[model samples]
Target: MSVDVRWLGHSTVTVDVRTPGGSLRVVTDPVLRPGLAHLRRRPATPDPAAWAGCDLALVSHLHHDHLDLPSLRRMRPTVLVTPPGSSDWVRWRLRRPATHVVEVAVGQTRELPTPCGPVQVTALPAHHAGHRTGSGFSRAPRGAEAVEHLLRVPGAFPGRDLDDLLLWAIGDTGEFAGSDAVLAAAGRAPDVALVPVGGWGHTLGPHHLDPRQAAELVARVRPGVSVPVHWGTLHPVALGATMGDRFVEPGRRFVREASRLGVAGAVQLPVGGSLSV
Candidate 1:
């Protein structure tokens, strides 16, 4: 089977995993350059026109970078997979009428018909929580007299469809069973695994996996090939001031850790780079 994977910079990737009949195109976190905070100053920019034509787009979480609305709207994929509450916000932004958005919960799966074959999307557990900041009353006023709407749980969403396709862990801050979803999805071994190797800045957040952690994950999943993402593209607000010197360490750590693990599966590609499997 021939599989094709492209690094769209950061956590975004266009994966063409070969199925028995044809090819399944999967995209992870498609981010455009302009709206993003750090990438704007680059001498050159990624040509959005060249981005992969994806069959499905996966919004790993609710973060601005991961679930970038502009980029998602641009891709306009037929199917969008994301954590609960994501569809509603995305739909509101799109203003293209109610769209076919699938909300997934951890440990569930959904299968969609595709040209190559049926592509299955699975929701893996994430330890990190999603939040939306708000202030002032909107058109609807909060009830002072009566009980108000209960605050929705951070991770709640519609039912999940954890089916045939491999696992896609949205994002996590800590080491938990939910964090282990990648291992479960791989199920002993996977043809290829796309893992988060960096966070928003030089410092690794408690919620995301840095390159070293990603290397640890690669060892556990034991995939035939491991591709690192989520780094080198965006710098944190604090680090952005001095990003010139901070971006390369995570990737280098990933490589070093992989070497130490004696795991020959690690493969690194340049930004907007691609590799055939």
Candidate 2:
């Protein structure tokens, strides 16, 4: 079964997972609107409305951009999955009765039942802390660690030995030692890897992975296909003039790094584009 992946912007993507059991559509960290605070989406979203709605949403962390309440509301995924310690915050912050919210801690795997079938979701450790603190905003729950989600498809199908396709969303994270071991716990390599190669601001902290680091990780993971994300998207409104090639450079650099590393199937997908693997 082939997987269909669509890049909305930043770390947000819609993956249509099809397996023998059934088909499920999942969105990641949706920021569907035109702008997030002062950071405006560049190149413009072809159709923000197209990213709305999903069977499930995989919120990797509590960062404002990654776990936007308004965006989630717009998308209206039947279920919202976030890291541990943030579920309560999300429910309260959303200002609604979000009873379907679930928390998945690092190294924990849970099977979520969808209309089609159950899908296995695993929380993998990331090097960043998932705390949301800013002016005029409630601080996110303490001890909320950032995470990467491994979405394994077609879970727990009887007699068929399902869970064939694995889509790994390597959310915002810095390169850490022995991260491969954490990824190996998925029991199999990812079929399609979504790697973050850039950021919204001018400089990236140690908590984020740059273009080169993303390429290096992909080479190690050796996924069937790799697509660059978190770049060529949003940027601070004030720094828009100063951000010359910053939005597009990371993607080009990632492609170059992947080629240099001899990593095949590295794709540079534009915003509002889809990749099938």
Candidate 3:
């Protein structure tokens, strides 16, 4: 089987899985807007209409950038998958009429029916927080050891009602367990893995993977093809061309590291670029 993968920007990726019957398109984290809060999307905003035929949309977390309400409003995916306990928020946030939303947790798998065939989607563990605050600054925390510790504790934000509604963690044995479950549930390595290599910040915090770490993940997942994403799309407006390199560097670094790690079929594509694998 071969799939055409497109890097739309940030955590958004569109995959066209071709089969003997027909084609099925799956989109992950559809954030098609130009600007959000202090972060301004870089050039080449993808056409929103590109998402019209998406059969399945997967949202990794509740962060505004990944689950932008405005962006989701424009999309018309047949089914939307979000982390467990996120259906209510997703429904409330969306401006348009309701779309079919499915809540999935780590290790849970869903089979999406398409004209081509049945495509299995397993919700794998991600080492990132799922908390979302109205203020963007609250979501982008800095520091190293301290932040890492806080992120490891799922739903660390005490007394915050929203945090209580979602599960988030990293640097924990449970994350590994969930990953193992996903692999076992699939019964084989996935055809393509969309891994987040970096974020829109000067330095990566806990629960997030840099280039080297992302490559390590690819080695573990052992997918037929691994594509590096979550980079080269958005940046802080205040930094303004000073740290412009951060946007593109992570993806490039991940490609080099994936090659060094001997991951089979590691591929990197520019934003708005597509590759058939």
Candidate 4:
């Protein structure tokens, strides 16, 4: 079996998990607009049809860049998974109750049914905080908990080191002390990992992973394929072309750093690009 992973800029990813039984498409953090706040997407916004038929969508957190309501409403996957404490804002703002939204907590597993087979989703711990100004009554869900995700199919890929076709989407986060145990929840390395390597502004700072840290994560997770995301797609408009390495270098830098760390499978996908593994 093989899976196609597409990096749709920032933390947004479309994973097409294919198996003999069937195919399941999972999209993460759908921020599909051209611009938001001080940031502007450098890549073309994906057509809604590109993701409209996804089996499941994962929301890492409620920051505007990750959980754009307009983008979600446009794609409208069969089911949506998010960290706990996100329902209220979606219910109030999204206003699309017809969309099946499941609130999953860390360590909890939920089975998502598709036409082909059942896909298991497990929320993992992340080390990011959602800041709020005035209760999030205006925009974004400030109280939502951010999380990483481990997606698996019971028997998709055959003749691999792992029986199940496991993939991990490591959303926006920085290194934390107990992260080894957190990553150990899945018991083993995933077949594929979509990791954030940079932020939209000057630096990723301590709350997010820069290229070097992202490479370190690859050293730890040791996934079969480490696909870099969250870089080379968005930039701060004020700086114009002056952002230089911060805006345009994380993906390649992460690959290089990972290689230096002996992680041979680290790779990069241009925004809107997909790779099968």
Tens digits of lDDT, candidate 3, 60-107: 667777777777777877777766666666666664454778765555
lDDT of 4 by residue, 1-277 (tens): 7777887788888888777787888899898899876778877988665576878888887777877778888777778887778766675667667678887788898887875688788888888875433454675556678888888876667776566877888778888875544357678778888889988887567879888998998898788899888777777776757777665678889999999999979988877788888
Please provide, for model 2 over 1-277, each residue's C-alpha lDDT reduced to its tens digit, 9 standing for 90 to 100. Answer: 6578888889988888666666678888888777877788777764755565478899988887788788887667888898888888788777656437898988889999886678788898888878875723576677787899898775422344544667888888998986665357767667788899989888999988898999999888888788898888888877788888887789889989999999998898888889887
Q: Is candidate 2 or 3 superior in TM-score? A: 2
Q: lDDT tens string, model 1, 97-210?
A: 423677665556666666565556666655554543231322111211100000011111113232233434333344455444455554545556676777655465666777
CA deviation > 4 Å runs, candidate 3: 135-181
TM-score of each: 0.78, 0.92, 0.80, 0.92
| Candidate with best lDDT | 2
What order do you get sorting by TM-score, best first?
Answer: 4, 2, 3, 1
Q: By TM-score, how accurate is candidate 2? A: 0.92
How many steric clashes does model 4 contain?
0
lDDT on C-alpha atoms for all candidate structures: 0.59, 0.81, 0.63, 0.79
lDDT value for candidate 4? 0.79
Better of 1 and 2 by lDDT: 2
